[model samples]
Target: MNRRHFLGSSGGLLAGLALPTLASAAVAAPSATGSAASSSAGGRGYRPVVTLGGRTLGFRLNNGVKEFHLIAEEVEQEVAPGMSARFWGYNGGSPGPTIEAVEGDTVRIFVSNRLPEHTTIHWHGLLLPNGMDGVGGLNQPQIKPGETFRYEFRLTKSGTFMYHPHADETLQMAQGMMGLFIVHPKNARERPVDRDYAFLLASYKIDPGTRRPDPSEMTDFNLWTFNSRTFPAIPPLLARTGERVRIRVGNLTMTNHPIHLHGHDFRVTGTDGGWIPAAAQWPEVTTDVAVGQMRVIEFIANAPGDWAFHCHKSHHTMGPMGHGVPNLVGVDQKAATAKLEKLFDGQHYMEMGSSGMAEMQDMAAMGSMMPLPTNTLPMMTGEGPFGPIEMGGMFTTLKVRDSLAPNDERDPGWYTHPQGSVANKVDPKRTDGLPR
Candidate 1:
């Protein structure tokens, strides 16, 4: 879709997430000076090739981020005994792996297309070389099936970024094929927080009639999720009360998402790699994640209830099964629906009965029986700690358990201790610390 189409399709800019026009960014033309330099630097560069399917495609991991291969392949997963459908994935699953690296590190990624159609991988919200931006045929050409493309750049700045097919982005991304990239800072902080969690929040637009994904439909973003699965299917982000927690957010949708967390206003520490000191950090009840953007915030899990964290876009918290258009049938069907309505009587987005009630009822009905797939927080749709509205299918609880030891039992918000904190990670100041 063109720029106009993307923005307009979302019914104008999402409340507070309007982007500066591309013209204002002055990116309409490539800098001749930089292109010349990038060309010369291209030769003899470390050719890091990753095989796509069976063909080895080459790429270079320049700065520090290790280059990996991202392939969009179609896989058939058994959702039921005899029910199977093709799913789009990166590496292998939807909301791909979390790529952890340090700030100021250069990373390269080789993208190979194995699908039957053309696609591109956009490094959502990453500041990289124009050629590596992954806008098919805009900055570079589309990677046709069986073709290989290299994306090389430095993680000069980092916070949270994601990769997803830019071509037919609405469709490709909706079918899955998204992943996270986290760049750590060279100057590590001695914070007391114990755990770090990266969230891949995405919403899928599924046609209610077919109960399948339809990227072409502009207003059907039906299922909202975290890490591809709904709650119950995913685990909770539990920690002891008063423990510090860091949550990195990656929003890959075309619309902005206001992620609301019940009972806490976490201090935002960083925005896409640049650090805002503690003094500058502010506590907000709801953090806004703009389309194709990233933000990192920290909070103390001091509350004790089953706190709900989900997109404020009411519809996003629902699934296709639950968001059915009301049927103006006979009074019997309507009465049965009215009885079901009592279940969500005091819940959110449950006002205007038929229009809103049918969808949720259908979603709950479908999810109640269908086996939930993965169990990672934030939960994907059709899974765990689901549906009290905000906490329903769209949320997973933060089950904070009291702990005095630094064990896996303790939920370390944003800290990962590998080999005693100096594991495979390298200090950005050191050249040979980690490979680019």
Candidate 2:
């Protein structure tokens, strides 16, 4: 989004303009909260959180309270290069901007409803006055379209939380109305991390060649995402070697995700309730984040490489893989290809899935001949320097390198392995690194 979208000096904001330029590639989440590379930039004595594929929400001071404005509106959100969908979100993006504040700070939030119907923001897992809890009808009246509602509360705890609609939740949330709310401890004397990252896991079931997501589909969702984006589009999490890295993940989808990290063991240091005390934490390579819950994990980025970080559920790492496709594996389709060609009057037809779907990676190379539908991403991924990356959706890499500019969040591209370290051919015809 343009800086003008949220750079208001005063609490004043423009009328709710909810239709995001859905194909706009630049807006997602912030590279780092409070500016991680520039310590103490967004907060005092506290490291900023990095919302992958997102940016942090900026605020203004009003009297003694921190004031913010969130416009609930419709958006055209890009899931990847070839896919865009009609989504509803705060501001202009899905998994709306991260809100960073300190515990004990008084906050007054103005929510403008630009949505077609009534909406309310339920502060999931935060203890606050009943009226400020944002449960639509129970705690307060719904913010009807074109109306603005105010929520004032003092942060009583520090943790990773979320905010989404409490009214017409099934339709609203399924349309991608959500964002992360992060509160830091106020004391400021605690251990600070070198690189802190946060993101929300979301899923969509947009049919192939469609522009709007289906909110009614309960299961069999095909498009999984990190901050409403798929792999090759979602930027990698960058860090300096040996840095103490913190990653906060929240799940809004109905299913659970066993989030796994490659080349590092981390400890679960926080949850939806609050930060976990040191004595209670343990080391693990993967942690499960359940529906409507959050988990904070931390570890030393001692290893240097482009390490894989993603959900462990195999299907979650793929795109638009709708259920019930014909099981054509192990069936030789060369004869079928000839028949297809004959039926098409000599137009070449390529066989797919008989030898498994890996051939789809070369779909781009084949160009117009491939039968992929419009407005859908391929199940696999974009090309790495080596070849097709065998992943997508809810997946990204943590690029920990020995040399990176302080606070730099740009993708460093592919990792170059030392010559002898990469696997090589072992037959006699192979290069004679060792005596053949």
Candidate 3:
């Protein structure tokens, strides 16, 4: 049988496979007189956590406990400019909201399941009791539809982590159910950072002329995303020059992502496992985040410019595309096009990819001539300063400026390059003795 047939037949078996048994334990007692808020008051100062264009998860204070609520439901989200998709997420956004807390503080997170199916939130890389691990039918009971479950745990460690459904793992995650969980160190002075940001890397396979993403896609994924958003829509990481910047990235996709930043060499400061010692850390321009893992990278924002930060995998930077298109790269279609144009009025066809594929951008800019299915994005998009960037998925910029307003999180627009800094064609008149 073919792969599709085998997958269809074994879907039920895969869903029924039992997860590893986890030891059940009683919930940890709340801290006596839980007033650790004063510890963060003047001692370490408030760490200004950034989430690019994303919002941080807010909490209510109840008897010295940081209480948060997350509701799992369906949401219609814009992946990029002019493109939107219906996704399953928490609190109405994919890659749900960023959850932030201070190390050593007690947090009470309440997850209400509004999805049609059961779900649970596994605090990825967090040190918590087995019963509160959020694995359905393994650690605790699944949060059924319309039911609420409470998970109380202490932030014993400080680092970047992730949260996603442990039940119906494949379909749920592919449908955009995930979030970033951050724990700041109590003593911010120990590892101080001027700007801290985090985002989750996810992928989806949305076939042409379709609105819903295919969750059963194992290898070929077309829509690569950052926090469930594509290029122009993915918010820029803004920072002031000379500031110490920390970017935490988590990968929930099936494939690994080798993220590369253009103008800086950064160090892998932390990982899902824990913090990497300063002595053992090495400088890298690109760091590979494996599946189900997270990596924290730090760098000094000394470069004052708009630099590209994106997945090194070239195809990951593209939007939804058909996989069965014919390869017209080196083909000479002039004669064929001439014959076809005679049959149609005012129709022009160009064979692309002969001299490097810049024409692909033009085609993308033209938009679809045929009507596409509802809620589907174009194969390529994203308007840039120069023109159509011809890029869509898994792409964003790190904009470092000399100065920015206090608490400014807005996109400062494109940068102004210094004189002679931009690339241009060499003058033919100046090439006196060059090879002709």
lDDT of 3 by residue, 180-210 (tens): 8878788777788777778889999877655
Flag regions of model 3 displaced more than 4 Å: 1-44, 339-356, 363-374, 429-436
Candidate 1 lDDT over residue span 1-436, tens digit each: 3222233223222223212221121111111111101011111111111110111111222232334556678755322222233468765556654454455656556666878899988877678889888888799888999987777787776465667777987778777778766555444453334556666776665443333455675554655666665544444565566777777777766678888887788888877545677788888988898876777778888765456677776666544443464654332354555566677683333222345354544554555423333321211233223333323335655555454333243333432223553336667688876666
Q: Tell how far residue 168 is off in model 2, in angstroms.
A: 0.9
**Candidate 3 lDDT trough over 10 residues, lowest sum:** 21-30
Candidates sorted on TM-score, descending: 2, 3, 1
Alpha-carbon runs more than 4 Å astray in model 2:
1-35, 38-43, 363-371, 428-436
Clashes found in each candidate (C-alpha, N, C closer than 3 A): 42, 12, 0
Global local distance difference test of model 2? 0.81
| Angstrom error at residue 251, model 1 | 1.9
**Candidate 2 structure quality by residue, lDDT tens digits, 1-436:** 2332233332233222222322131212346322454233223445567888778776655454666778899999788997888999988899888887878888777888998899999999889999998888899998998998889999999989999989999989999999999898876667578778889999988989897879898998999999999997888888888888889999999999999999999999999999899999989999999999999999999888889999999999998885898898999989988999999999988787887778777765556437679998888886777777779998898998888766777777788777797776677755568664
Model 1 segments more than 4 A misplaced: 1-65, 76-85, 190-192, 207-212, 321-324, 327-391, 404-436
**Model 3, residue 153: C-alpha shift (Å):** 1.3
lDDT of each: 0.54, 0.81, 0.77
Indicate the worst ten consecutive residues by lDDT in candidate 2: 19-28
lDDT for 283 in candidate 3 is 96
